[model samples]
Target: MASGFSLKDQLFNREKTRYLAGLFAASHAGFDPDRFEAEVMAELPALELKQRISLIAEVLSRHLPQDPEGMAAAILNALPPPLDPSLSDDDFGDFIFAPLGELVELRALETAPDLSLDVLAEITKRFSMEWAIRPYLVHWTDKTLARMEVWAEDENYHLRRLVSEGTRPRLPWGQAVPLALSQPLPLLDRLSGDPTRYVTRSVANHLNDISKKDPELVLTRLRQWQAEGVQSQSELDWITTHALRGLVKQGHSGAMEMLGYDPAAPVTAHLQLGPGPVRIGGALEFDCMLQGPSDAPVLVDYRLHFQRPGGKLSAKVFKLKQTRLKGGTARLSKRHPLKAGASTFTLVPGLHRLDLLVNGIERGSLTFDLLAQAE
Candidate 1:
């Protein structure tokens, strides 16, 4: 599987290179003997993932039929099938995505919109061309969006997923579409009732993305969906929970109430942090002692207010646990590992505060000293 961070390793490895060579050979045999492989191999180790894709596109530009449409047609020829073999087969990840997706991205924007749409409609079914499709949506918004509405009705789940995923206003790792950001309700209306888990998940995530901008609108729609009962109950539940995850975490009252969390539920909490002055990269153990209304469900989370090197503090919340306290009190102990390896933050030495959030309400807090990291 391709790791999220490094597609270069997963896509451009020796075996993948040979596979690409083989696929090109199988499709267009007269291209080259050693020359094509030489060009690709030379660039493989030298470039990152984005650079590699661009380089491959450039290489294809030199070799494929001269005209852009002809080139697109030739590249489109390389695709195996829309939904012939499931993506679970090993070849789907880099084998299809690295080579084919790049071709769609590099050429589709420049080619005729219809031709590009034709290729994208097929390419997306195999591996998403969501990133490539953005340019079209931005420049040719109406036509592309009309087509997307039709795609929302496609029989294939992949196509349905693309309808929501591609049109997301704030798609992570994807280019932002300003139009989609402003007016996603129409697409959501079309895609929201989709029953497929894969499609519904994308729709939920798309709504979640919109939620960040207009939390109230998304909440209203989610509440409406819950009331309508038009979609699959289980899928809707999943969508509602995930779509409201961000708002729920922030302790929005409407969001909390939608999830049946009663803010007025009486609860008392005490937080304890152990063994002051722990070193960076060491573990910090803490306990949350709580007494709450009997048999009530609780969602427990903690926030770490980390001090920056410049002395400003930035806080991030992490879920601790969720359980039903069937009785008088419960004490939960947790270990937080403080390591500075490949994470967003480097564990800096400063005064750090940890807080307990019960049902999205910050109830208790304590501070601890993190000693300067060892040289």
Candidate 2:
């Protein structure tokens, strides 16, 4: 990423706030675009990304009619044309319209849930309503799910994606819904065959979240989907790989087998680390050779056991290579970076370890010293 990049600014800024205000102003004669823009801008820069979204929604509540029907009408009318329908994938729509979903949640969740769902269905075409739909799922579980069953078959791909994305067990930055992991499986069953990558990716991610809690549940579902063959063989393969990513990192034998890797295959690994201590802001270079049965596929991954300040080691997994052995042998190498300045995780100078995993089995490991960067 470029230095000084601000995601919040890029997603929600003065221009975006003003654009939303203009849309509403055009829809409602009584709506004042300048006032709405001013109120949202006042706190938008000071707040974080999510807070900015709430700030805009709160401002909308004060400006728009308080009644549920009028509010819903204003929001729906204000929305720009639905995102291009010709595109098959990778269109997430605009971020400015997200507040519209939040506004719907605030104005009509309890008093007029059906109307709220109606508005969200339209608003989602301009932007995903994944976050807004969770409260309904938590409070009106059966009712909301019943509605989702209908949405799963909607003509709009975005609405179809909302069904899967909204129900994710571990949706990032999303509100937690208390539904049982299995409860949403039925909905996923319907969405698993969606032709759009946008929808299928969400289905895969939702299953990946479930795999964290119930590996067998996800494995079983994948098996059933494969047997049923609702989706093409290639597309289902993509979904299976994406959904089982977490389990693969954990060296789950069942997940490995499901992906057609033999966890118990006879394999031997030899690891060699580059000379000299690795410093922060430098790279940790290493190479390895694997000896396995000819024509057998191998899923190779390297785990780095990072040393923390208090002598505890935090392990992180990274993909190395995925290929079939040639002449019963394969060679792989990597140059992992050690950045001194990182936003999330800090690097500590100390002894660290790297372990090689092939087909969900640890084959070899070695230790190396990490040094502080030069001042």
Q: Residue 246 deviation, candidate 2, in Å?
A: 0.3
Cα error of candidate 1 at position 124, Å: 1.5
Runs of candidate 2 with Cα error greater than 4 angstroms are: none
lDDT over C-alpha atoms for residue 108 of model 2: 92
Name the regions of candidate 1 deviating beyond 4 angstroms: 1-7, 83-92, 108-111, 180-182, 275-277, 341-343, 373-375
What's the lDDT of the predicted structure labeled candidate 2? 0.93
Each prediction's TM-score against the native? 0.89, 0.98
Candidate 2 C-alpha lDDT tens digits along 1-375: 999999999999988888888888999989999988888887788899989989999999999999999999989889899998888788998998888888888889989999999999998898999998999998888889999999999999999999999999999989899989999999999998989999999999999999999999999999999999999999999999999999999999999999999999999999999877799989999999999899889999999999988999999999999999888999999999998889888999999999999998999999998989978
Instruction: State, as a TM-score between 0 and 1, how close model 1 is to the true structure.
Output: 0.89
lDDT score at residue 14, model 1, on the 0-100 scale:
64
Summarize candidate 1's per-residue lDDT along 1-375 as a digit string, tens digits: 333656567666667656666666677646662666788778778887777767766776666776658766676676665664334222222333545665655655655777778777887766777777887887778888888888878777677677788888788767767574546577777677876667777877887887788888888888777787778777787888888888877877777777777767788898988766577877778998888888777778898998887999988888887776779577888998888553567777888899898888988998888876666
Colliding residue pairs in candidate 2: none
